[model samples]
Target: MAQQERAIRTRRTILEAAGAVFDEYGYASTTISMVLERADVTKGALYFHFSSKESLAQAVLDEQVPFGAVPEQPCKLQEIIDMTFVVAQRLLTDSLLRGSVRLTVDQATPPGVDHSGPFRQWAERLIALMEQARSQGELLPTVQPRDTVELLVGGFAGIQLMSRALTDRADLAHRVSVLWSHILPSLAVPGLLLGLDSKADRGLRVLSAVPVS
Candidate 1:
């Protein structure tokens, strides 16, 4: 058990080191040596975990998902808003996530890399929630889930990028809240809008309740 746990730790260390390097120097310029130095591990150890820089970057992108928390809201639309804010909050503190976003938007992404996977996954999740919201009468009759997926996913990417540049993501939760505040009233049913909680602090409260995993 101890040996398995140590292997997990080693892999995590290598990923973080690679992320910090990629976050600093970008994917193209980041070298294995840089990661090795940051990780303070031998070449064989890193090779055992990640074979090449492309794989490391892909792993970083993969790290973008699979960890988050939000309270169960009566409205799926509200849950969507909560989901975005909590992730924005995480981007402020988690290097793995921050690095993933940077890698996703970095102009020099590698050929054949699966950078689209995360976006697709997010779009699919949003589509599912919007479909649920529609079933629950949270959305207007005309608000199609497919269209909502496009708007919410694209809007979120823009909001997060702008926040990262302008305020170093310090205002991400607030900006995300502002985004929902503008978009929700138009898409949500009047009855649902009144009950939806899109406050900037919603992320903080939810994080406090469930905490990030």
Candidate 2:
């Protein structure tokens, strides 16, 4: 048990170090030596945990995926949107997560390794959440769950990319709100618009407070 605990801690240290380095100097410029130097772990320990840098990179990517206990009961569409925004905020605030997001966006178009699993898994979870919302009559009858999932994921990805470029210039919340306001209304039932609108307003307010950069 002690051995396992130490291994886990070592792995976490490596991930944290890698994330910081990646954030400081993008994937192309980052090096294994830098990761080791940042982590302060012996080369043997790193090699023991991960066979190669790509594997370590994959580990870093895996660590960033949002996977926590969600509400047991069905969540309102607005609630889900708020939760998603909160997760985004966390990612934006976390240096490691921020670096991971940058790396993911950079590698999304041109795959170098097998780090896509986390993304696909994230998309799948969103799709499942949408389906749940649909079953609860939270979505409009006209809204296609799959399409909504695609839009939400795709739009979020686009915003993440934009956030990376405009890290110091753009407010993530405002950008998210603008995109959400435009896309959300169309995805909800007529009577549900009021709730969503309120949520969007709140989301906008919350996002406005998030510092750019």
Candidate 3:
């Protein structure tokens, strides 16, 4: 148990060091030696945990991606939206994660790496929630769940990029709130707006290792 605990601590140290180095130097310019130095670990120790730099980068992504705290509940539209914003805020506020986002966006189409797993998982979950909401009549009759999911995810990603570029000084929370408020009225079923208006009654909930920005 003690050995396992030590291993866990070492792995976490490596990841945190990698994130810091990547954030400071950008991914393309960062090297394993730099990570080793930052982590204060021997080459063998780093290799024991991560086979390669690519694997280390993947580990960083796995560590940073935020997951919902509400679990897979009844899939109410408002619930999903609330969860998304919570996760978004968590991601946006995290400097490390914002750096990760920058790396992902910059290296999304790297030569042999499939970087779409996280994005696809995010879209899939949102699509599932939207589909459930559509079935429950929470969305407009004309709203297509798949298309709306695409739009929402795409728009959210775009906004996040903009927010990062602007260094989060533009009141991202307020802007996101306003954007959702305007968009929800169009996407939601006629009487569902009231429920959405009450979304603030529930606080932001998220699951991730990084601190909220």
Clash number for every model? 0, 0, 1
lDDT for model 3? 0.68
Q: Write the per-residue lDDT of candidate 2 for residues 114-190, one digit (tens) a residue.
A: 65665676677777778888888878789887777777777877886777677741466667777777877788777
What TM-score fits each model?
Answer: 0.93, 0.82, 0.80
The residue ranges of model 2 lying beyond 4 angstroms of the native Cα positions read 67-73, 108-112, 197-213
lDDT of each: 0.82, 0.70, 0.68
Q: How many backbone clashes does candidate 2 have?
A: 0
Candidate order (lDDT): 1, 2, 3
Candidate 3 weakest lDDT stretch, 10 residues: 198-207
lDDT of 1 by residue, 23-142 (tens): 778878889999999999999998898888888889989987654456777788888888888888778777787778788778788786777777887888778888988898888888
User: Which residue pairs come into collision in candidate 3?
Assistant: 93-213
True-structure Cα RMSD, model 1:
1.6
Worst 10 residues of 1 by lDDT: 65-74
Candidate 1 matches the true fold with a TM-score of 0.93
Best by lDDT: 1
